[model samples]
Target: MASITSSGLGSGLNVNDIISQLMEIESQPLTKLQDKAKEAQAKISAIGTLQGALSTFQGRVLSLSSASAYKSLKGSLADTTIGTVSTAVNAQAGSYSLAVTQLAQAHKLKSQSFSSVNAPVGTGSMTIQFGTYDDKGTSGNAADDTFEVNGDKGALTIEIDSTNNTLTGLRDAINAKKAGVTATIVNDGSGYRLLLSSSDSGKANSLKITTDDADGNDTDTAGLSRFSYDPLGTKNLTQTQAAQNAEFQLDGIAISKSSNTVTDVLQGVTLTLQKVSARDTNNAPVATSLNISRDTSGVKTAVEDFVKSYNEFVKSVEGLSFYNKDDNSAGLLNGDYVIRSMQSSIRSTLNQGLGSGSYYQSLGAVGVSFDDKGNMTLDSTKLQKALDTRPEDVASLFAVNGVTSDARVSYVSSTAATQVGSFGVSISSPATRGNFSGLAVANGPITIAEGDNDMLMVAVDGASSGQIKLSPGSYATPAALAAEIQSKINGDSRLKDANAAVTVSYNATSGKFEMSSNKYGAKSNVQITATGSATEATLGFKVAQGGTGSDVVGTINGEPAKGDGQVLTGSGKAEGLKLTITGDTAGEYGTIGFSRGFASKLDQTVTSMLSDNGLLRSRIDGLNRDLKNIGAQGNTVTRRLEDIEKRYRAQFTALDVQIATMNSTSTYLSQQLSMLNNLASGNKK
Candidate 1:
């Protein structure tokens, strides 16, 4: 019988267990690599957390980097029912008595009653003009009214064909144009009628519609002529409400405005008229008190928010790099240089002084400071004192600010490239506007005939005005003629669309009519390109070119700067500094002192730390590279461990087999010897 024995049983040793123990010992390096990779991943996640906190803190810092935030103004009224008031940054603190006598109203007109909304109203074309109507000499009759077209509003022409001959079609067509007038149909129990109203609430926005009926009779109350509302001729539409100005009393002075919302009367103050003031026993308008004052609550809130956000950020940093001495544990980024550097940079910026020649130079001057624990604290009382006494200085201490000595040389803007220092401003030549000087008139009152001296073409600021038509009337003086020309030129649709306008003035000394562009630059110019047949005879204006405008020549910090319109941009060390020169004199204006404040500096630092190639990104990229290397090494060690385990298994199996073979041989020999001994003993017996 053949004896079958397992290799481990014959050797009296467990081969599987021995091989497992050896393999475990050999993979120590790979295990250490895996632990290192996990640490790297944890550190990367910690950095991401730090970046998120920094970003949240940066948003609060940016709020204090502009001067407008600190220039808030508040308005209050003793009687809120009278009207509402709003104020701008430039508004002065004062008290005023206001009395609203009238509210501006838009003009409304209605056509004669019709049978239905779809009633037929034959059509050809209709032209709508916006203007002011003068009823000074007329009683209540509409035929004696005088209308003067508003130069600021251009006349709009609309075509009416058979497709839109009905009242509803005409209403829809007029609405589609958005031509400063709204049309609707109304039923007054007797019949339906077409109602039209001006889009704006001002005396100068009244509508005057004229039509050319397809039936060849335009003034008759038939066809499209029924909608005509020319004050001089047809009067088919009846005026229900006339456009009027708003009348009010400010500090005992009577004031009138074209709109109910008055802005220009008060400096930086806007008043919206709601209702007429209550009348007293004597039929006089009652007065309401309006008070304007500086608002400081917004600045205080901004400072508080900044301090809270900054303290929270500091706490986050400390927590990320914390170390537990008692427990013998460490945070993921226990000794990170990048995190430490970021905190240090921000702290240094906050501590730096702003050399802006302001009363307040640093955050400490406005009662913001850091404690021993690196947490920011705000002194509310002290901050309020500074804001109340030196508000502009406090604003300059937290924003990128510029101060000019001359009021005419105002600081427009500056860029990051602009250096923080005083720069000398010297203007060699001031800006000039382009102008056209027409020939002098022969005698007095110029007569503008229809179709004779009415049409002309003009170009303003290099933008052409196509076929501008002048209103036919009699001018008493050169000033009146100048006003008429200015009105006609500015009312051109082509020039208005291009944002180009002109101011026509009568030069009494030169005895000439001058038309100048409203813009001031090298491209600012006005030219009369074409004229009517009698234009030269009546208006004394022939086809002529105006003088070209010249740009402003100046130097900033002794370096030649670029000029466009009224803006002058500096170069060299003063690069990106924009200044507006409004003075006509050509000489040294003054120096502009500039500085970058704490909030601006700190914002820049945090922005740099969080950019794509910033500190956190670089560190994360390096840790990722280390993780990849560790993974590669782990793969290599795993391959080597597989070979080592195979070799160990093979050697142990061979030793077991050899031991089994030896044991079997010894047993066989012993058995043979025993048999021989037994036989010899039997022979001996």
Candidate 2:
């Protein structure tokens, strides 16, 4: 009999193909396992979605809790703030107090001087002299000379170096010592000549005619003892400042000034004085800080926002806890551990701990309720009752005790850092401040008031020349002298070298040199300082160099300005520059400008808020992409499972055919073998 080896398969596929088929079948189970895992992950993610909604609900319910506390206290739940205060109507005539803080002015006059009558000699003890230079004491060339007005013997001299020729020796020799007023040369069309004028302005703005060069009176040839005079001369005696300091007190704060107003002493505060009127009355305006504002709508908006958020959270929890009556009676969060955890978390939002204050302490006291569906409902009457009960306690709940984050919330808000401040430090906003101008005067180079570490230095450096120099003993008026000096400067080449020009500027309002201009841009800059004392006499000199004309403004200091007739604006004192700050710094109500300098950080912070978009949106988009991938994979798996089922069915059908044929063949063979055995048995018999 032929032996059937293990390789006896009726001509079908080999074991390798069957093994590959088996591997494909095994792969379907793994794919199904992976898909199931993805679904489980998606469900887990959906469960925690209520956390944000719960947080929002807590915030809103908190307001109701806050309002109840407010009502219980004496304060109203509707407290609010009004800013950039617009409606501050000016007080009528009988409505304010008027007081003159401080003022000093060079009252102008149209008057003449003492009509002169003096020969070359007289008998008064004092002698009046001229030809004073810009630097030295005196000189005696027709160009550099001296004359005297005698108050003693009434003697006068005109030594065009004629007296002992020692006069010429006097001026020529001392030109370089550089002691006092000396001759300065300027060449107009009429050859180079010298003029006598004070190096300063105002009353100290003068030429004190005397008979000396250094410390000598008629002793040597440099003295007026060897002088002469012009027969016809008169000078204008203008009203000018004797001292530069303007001082008084504001609410007794001891304000020292060099101009008409003080600025930025307090944030956004400016004080202007309109020269104390002779009949000061309550009708004239002054100010104090007792006034309060009335509108309170911001408080309402804040409470409403809180409530809306709280209600949304309550609704979320309710949805998760219940089942839908339709469609498989399914709850999306059914069997979710995260959903229960979030529901418990939301309950804690409105339950802030109470303090010892008298008003509403808990959200339960207000009309806030969560239904079986977890939707929050507002009970206005119950809310009102809580307000009537514990108002202070409610106020304490929402009155910004600690930060939520920095301004509002955070992880350890209960132990957050306390904000200590000397100035308004809004890191989220620009730190706003204004520049000061006019004259902030002090006592000396500095003053040493007893017991005080600080001193007062109130000399004004930014003053318009209040008076013209008048001393040659020959000019008809100070205006004439001013005209001559102005003419000489306008005609001189060296004036450009000196970077100085004397131009007459006029203001119809104040009638003075209250305006000036320079080479368009930065050439207009100048440094001004005062060198006199303040006391019971005439104010000292008001001198300005780079600025000229009655076009000069009544600035607080040399910082420059534009007076709105009431408030001064632009170019103030601080950081040591004559700045032209562009804004209404002295508006009655405070206004803020978005400056790039002061608010740079705020800009970056706002930019920072915008910056959060890229990162957060990226993360959200990544989640969306991940979700899409999961969904796409789930779809793929579902379709693949269907295809696999069909293919597996086809495979099983073919396998059944093969097995059926084998079984039939086996039966046929067995029958043939039995028939053969029977035939053999018969034949053998």
Clash count for each candidate, listed in order shown? 0, 91
Model 1 — which ten-residue stretch has the worst lDDT?
1-10
lDDT of 1 by residue, 1-685 (tens): 3443454866889878888888889989998999999999999999999999999999999998887777778887788988799998778788999998999999899999999988998989877778777886648676566666665565666678989999999899888767588999999999999999998888888888888799999889999999999766668999999899999999999998888888998788999898999999999999999898889999999999999999999888888888989997877788888877887788788777666345477788888988888789999999999887767667778877777788789788889898877789999998888877888775467778879998889888889988876666676666766666776677566887898998877788787888889899898988889999999777667887576787788999899999997889999988999999998879998988777877888889888888888888899999999999999999999999999987987787778778878998999999999999999999999
Question: Alpha-carbon error at 423 in model 2, in Å?
Answer: 27
Q: Cα RMSD to native, each candidate? A: 3.0, 22.0
Task: Give the Å error, residue 101, model 2.
Answer: 16
On a 0 to 100 scale, what is the lDDT of residue 61 in model 2?
40
Ten contiguous residues minimizing lDDT sum, candidate 2: 420-429
Score every model by TM-score: 0.92, 0.31
- Residue pairs of candidate 1 with colliding backbone atoms: none
State the lDDT of candidate 2 residue by residue for 1-685, as single tens digits: 2222222142343634664576577567557756655655555454445445543543444443322223221111111211011121111111112234445332121111112211122121222222212322255334443222211111122222333223233333224323223433334444433233222222212233333232244333233332322222222222222323234343445555534444433322234444542323755323222122222233334455656665665566556556766765645557555455444433443343333322334545566555675555666676555444433333444542211112211111111122111111111111121111223232222222222311111111222222222222233322233233233222222333444343322232332222122222223322223222331011121333233112123232233444322222333321111212222232212211111110111122223222435322333455566666766776776677667666755565556566657777898999999999999999998
**Per-model C-alpha lDDT, please?**
0.84, 0.34
